[model samples]
Target: MKHARPLPAYMVTRYHGWKATTHAENKGWYRRLADEGQRPRAMIISCCDSRVHVTSIFGADQGEFFIHRNIANLVPPFQPDGSQHGTSAAVEYAVTALKVSHLVVLGHSSCGGVAGCYDMCSGNAPELEETGSFVGRWMDILRPGYDMLPEGDDEARTRALEKVSVTVSLNNLMTFPFVQKAVEEGTLSLHGLWNDIGEGTLEGYDPDVDAFVAI
Candidate 1:
């Protein structure tokens, strides 16, 4: 704690600004949220990319959605071994503790993690190919999706692969026992979504069509 640096001036100023503006305006709402606790309807799993604003995308306010973000928005297969699992812990909490009605895996265009995976699989990214690279190891979860990538130009393939990452995460989420049981009981629903960041358009996975359709 002693080694950690103080907050940057800009960030501190922004926090004060928000506290005086948005937080002041919504004081009652914030107080109610703190008193009653959050009962978010959905748990949104999104990428850690700064450009991907989960709340802004849905026009949502505080306490509306429980969000978990990570590289590529990937969800690894359930292992349950005595090991630290950030994403799994979040999923468990959202399903068991929160009882969220919907669990959404959100992927987006121009995703660096997905691109890194593609390069790693293609033998092009030496840095990520290293066994010690955490990002490379984490991205191994998306290998199944890489297998399903359709033949196309680089741009098209990358975009299609982005959606594939979402699809893969949705499929992997079902591997968790709690998720499976909740889904089977008709209490929890899983969804996959891909966003075109530049265009501000979202596409949803359609099991019937086996593809991402515009939403």
Candidate 2:
């Protein structure tokens, strides 16, 4: 049997200190938000990568954005599968319940999940014995983008595939019923963002230019 472990003393101390600071700086704002009700202006769909934190990247304060994180930040098309729909549920809540004005898909460079998809596409990885393993199934979401990439060096190919997957995921987001309806009504706007980790640069999708331009 596994036993639950308490948080490390250092971490506990750090957390309490951070909480005190937060409360000191934002107590009034928190009260107002609670009283008036939270109405975040945006929802961010982001990867579970520790290096690609959405709040820090966007300089968002607490209650400023509704956030959802998942493997590779993929948003599956809406379907009634009687299965858990983590990302989709967040989208539904953000659009339907929160009614956020903006929904942004945030992608980052050197994503391991995206790299795994590229490896699966190149047939370099061992074949999956089961069709339903978590990583295998999640990689399926990026299969179309993988199919679109040209065969080449593994590293370069993976990066390119990751970039393409962002575009694919953006398309997938539009296919969601709630997202489609919101966009059609013009109550919500969709944006795609790419963050280059090494370069510390951020880029936004420019539909008019058909490219990602540095922001």
Please name the candidate that would achieve the greatest TM-score relative to the true structure: 1
Q: Give the runs in model 1 whose Cα sits over 4 Å from its true position.
A: none
lDDT values for all models: 0.94, 0.84
Steric clash count of candidate 2:
0
lDDT of 2 by residue, 11-41 (tens): 9999999879987788898888888987899
Clashing pairs in 2: none
Error of 1 at 68 (Å): 0.1
**What is the model-wide C-alpha lDDT for candidate 1?**
0.94
Reference-based lDDT, residue 139, model 2: 79
Per lDDT, the best of the predicted structures is 1
lDDT of 1 by residue, 1-215 (tens): 78999999999999999999999999999999999999999999999999999999999999989999999999999998999999999999999999999999999989999999998887888899788999999999997777888898877887888998998898899999999999999999999999989999999999999988999
Candidate 2, which segments miss by more than 4 Å at Cα? Answer: 127-129
Model 2 lDDT on a 0 to 1 scale? 0.84
The 10-residue segment of model 1 with minimum total lDDT is 152-161
